[model samples]
Target: MRCLYCAHAMGLATCPLGTVVPILNRPENADILDLLNIPKDYEVAINMALGYPTESPEPPIRYSDKIKIVL
Candidate 1:
């Protein structure tokens, strides 16, 4: 379905060397839909906040302590 594609796109945006974010806000999607004047048939699938990140992103935290590296 189209929703799945939207989710996949969002996931890809957050993947390594990518830029995209989808965060939940205090207001509900209905509120946004009303403001954006999106047709009732449509819905706000993903709400994103765009801006220059204040600080450099840190690498994902890993569990190197328990897992053994087999190189």
Candidate 2:
């Protein structure tokens, strides 16, 4: 994640307003719209329907040929 709003990374956590604000989850209507004051130009990288995973996904099998360095 980019440290744009993180005070610890920027060394401003002690400042008055630099203390971070929490964005609360909003319901699915006009209330959510007001909560998220996203600009027109902004875009969401990921949007998820949050829930516990019923099954654990296995890691992909790695191929040995891909490990060689050409240089």
Candidate with best TM-score? 1
Q: Output the worst ten-in-a-row residue range by lDDT, candidate 2.
A: 18-27
Cα TM-score of candidate 1: 0.37
Assess each prediction's global lDDT (C-alpha) against the native: 0.47, 0.40
Q: Judged by lDDT, which candidate is best?
A: 1
- Candidate 1 per-residue C-alpha lDDT over 8-42 given as tens digits, one digit per residue, 9 for 90 to 100: 45552222211321222224445656676777676
Candidate 1 wrong stretches, greater than 4 Å: 1-31, 63-71
Clashing pairs in 2: none
Candidate 2 per-residue lDDT over residues 1-71, each given as its tens digit: 23333543554322232122222222233354355775434433433233334554564556756775443
Error of 1 at 5 (Å): 14
Clashes of 1: 0
Estimate the TM-score of every prediction.
Answer: 0.37, 0.28
